[model samples]
Target: MAHDASGGEIVAAAGTTGGKKAGFFARIVIFIRQVIAELRKVVTPTRKELLKFTAVVLGFVVIMMALVYGLDYLFSWVTTVVFGVPS
Candidate 1:
């Protein structure tokens, strides 16, 4: 067992592969185990944190939409003034 730079344990696989490649099913099992191990480390946000994040995202999106709409309106007005309102 060794420790990596990030302070995490560097785990070596138990048993030897005898210099032979793992079969397809063996590889799949290894991948699924790794996936499960990673999933176990995931942290879920609390309800308050989730709501705050959602509000922040929605507010940012609304601000961007308003900025785009204002720019579009300004461009349209300028175009109309320059082109004499398309007759």
Candidate 2:
């Protein structure tokens, strides 16, 4: 019952028995519409907040990488010391 800018008849409620099934174009339109609706509800962060979040995430990633690297090096050294060259 709905129509688009191109005057193409848009199908509605494909889930219903009498309703028409949506085609590929119709599905795309529906998906875009839903995305727009969701975006409208989103509360965007301010520039300062965005920068803070980015810095925090980057710091956490760096800390985790360092921790993993330290653990790996410690384990490798311990293994080498315990089991020397098997000649």
Candidate 3:
């Protein structure tokens, strides 16, 4: 229904009538259909792409962990110096 800056058309869910609740089997079928539709839209990465993504994520996590550890250590040291060492 809408177009993005890149000129890609966006599909919007249409609201018709206030839809009646589906029965249990009907709901399951609807769910399976939706899942298959979503799966069809998925783009899987190649092995090289997956490796690069994994490296980037791991590097980010390690950097964040080191940053947090440094801050916590600094705070603990300051607290100990100000309040004296714990008994």
Candidate 4:
């Protein structure tokens, strides 16, 4: 662990030599290489699967909206009755 200027504990990099530091360009190149590797591993879904996922997400959102609206109406009704106001 390494401490910062404010004495907060900091985690050291794994697989590091414990003394050597990587240059800015070296770090950028490594980051780009890792991103390319990850992109190569990605498997895009088919159009039918994409449509199904979108429909499921939309249905979930609609259900959640209805649930929230129902709760809000119930709470408002209860509050109005408690406060002796017109509902």
Best candidate, lDDT: 2
Pairs that collide in candidate 4 are none
Give each model a TM-score. 0.66, 0.63, 0.71, 0.74
Candidate 3: RMSD to truth = 6.6
RMSD (CA, Å), candidate 4 to true, equals 9.6
Clash pairs, candidate 1, are none
Q: What is the lDDT of residue 50 in candidate 4?
A: 100
Runs in model 3 deviating more than 4 A are 1-21
Report the number of the highest-TM-score candidate: 4
Per model, how many backbone clashes are there? 0, 0, 0, 0
Encode model 3's per-residue lDDT on 20-74: one tens digit a residue.
Answer: 5556786576566656666777999999999999999999999999999999999
Query: Residue 82 in candidate 1 has what lDDT?
Result: 86
lDDT tens digits by residue: candidate 1, 23-80: 7786676667666667777999999999999999999999999999999999999988
* Model 2 poorest 10 in a row by lDDT: 5-14
Question: Alpha carbon lDDT of residue 73, candidate 2?
Answer: 96
Q: Which digits, one per residue and each the tens of the lDDT, describe model 4 over residues 1-87?
A: 454454433444867777656567866765676566667779999999999999999999999999999999999999888898754
Q: Report the poorest 10 consecutive residues by lDDT, candidate 3.
A: 4-13
The alpha-carbon deviation from the true structure for residue 1 of candidate 4, after best TM-score superposition, in angstroms, is 22
Q: Between candidates 1 and 4, name the one with more favorable TM-score.
A: 4
